[model samples]
Target: MHYNLRHYRAEAERHSHADFHQIIISDVGKLELEVEGRAGEVCGRRMAFVEAGRSHAFRAEGLNRFLVLDVNIDLAHKTGIEALWQSRGRASAYLELQNGAQGSLLGLLDRRWFRSDASEFTGDGMPFTNAIGDPGLVDQIRLILGHSRQAVGTEKKTGSDIPTRLVRVMDWAETRLTEDIAISDMARIAAQSESTLFAAFQRYLGTSPMRWLTAKRLQMAWFLLQDCQIQLSIGDLANAVGFSDQSAFSRAFSRQFGRTPITVRRDARKLLGAKL
Candidate 1:
């Protein structure tokens, strides 16, 4: 959890973090970033993700302050950082932050990351304003850019219409939230190979298929946790959502929703109390 305000000197600074992922958000002025031979920049409206083990260099002129987050490579796996690394190049250049939520997201990040309370790129494939220091802030960023499509390379689909086969797959997954389903299972439902299914998901959903499945399962668990009409023990709720281990379920839920199962249940009780 390395969140800091960084400054690069006028000279080019080249380095690589082979053990962790680093997110660079532009603050005062423009900063050039070259990661793994690919180049991008961060202005007031841009940012960059430097994945682990990639050779990266940075250069900036005049006054500049950047907010950078260093994430463990393991945590980067299912949490939208992987696709971002894959989608960086050529046509997907300049990942720009979204319009309205940019201010709020940056404000929240500044409060949490910096001592004060404040944040793109050419590639709209990834949400640029994202700062994942807190679970609640991460969930907020999730809601803001959750609908945008992404691509693995450059052919990202920006259309609103969901791919028909993907829709079928989503609907099918919704019904089997409690089951032990995998990416192969989803590919089978889509009537395609796992690679093709993975590509389609990356192109249309901005995430991998298995990550989406985990998200869906956690979403169902959230719904159950917040429902006042139904009372399920935490372990029961976890089991109902395909989590054999309650501790793992709680960790995933907190990561996704910024709250624990017990907390969510308590909130529901508070809601009921208010209603009564």
Candidate 2:
């Protein structure tokens, strides 16, 4: 179940189905609301959630800006959407924001609106901003929530592209080579089954993920050793990139590039010596 905002006008907002729930907040002007066979009412700076099969029409007399969060309750529940949801599609959810959080959420929704309209941004994969609230906005939200609940956990990856996701996972692993990069975590980012991802990597990049990961580690180690400021022993660079033993790193490096890490570093030093 996707949650997004759709804006429409009086004449544009014609008779429609009541199968979805709408959370609407008028930011400006006025709107005349009517539930089928009922007296119409004017809505201003008001928010309401109208449920499915409930006949309703909204007509704004003048230019107005508002947010309409349309959600499918059944689908949302089935998908385990952890985001905040108002009472079972009956109450108008007017989120009273503290410390400018409301404005940020509005901005985020507006950006999604832009992306939804523009071909350059629209796609099948979920938009990155939608899954993880805007980083700056999320941080503030966390600060506000912190006072109300238990401590929040560390930041989680909110990215969803395959290649970009792979790069992000690898970058994190590069920093924490001492720890294993969970296969499950990588699978989540790739948005594919483990077998599918393996096949896709071989098809696209012509290498297995783990092999690619090892290559990246060796590359990082090589760079670290070549840097003049780095004064660590060969073993230090190996361990920094997840290799607990220098011999193992050397063997892997030699297998891939036909040269040991020490020789590579020595060769780099020679090049530097000649340049000086």
Instruction: Provide the RMSD of all predictions against the true structure, rounded to 1 decimal.
Output: 16.6, 21.3
List TM-scores for all candidates, in order.
0.44, 0.39
- Tens digits of per-residue lDDT, candidate 2, 195-268, equal 87677668666898788667767765655556543455788667656677889989998997898888888888
lDDT of 1 by residue, 195-237 (tens): 9999998988899988887887786666556655444578866
lDDT of 1 at 43: 61
166 in model 1: Cα distance from truth in Å? 41
Best by TM-score: 1
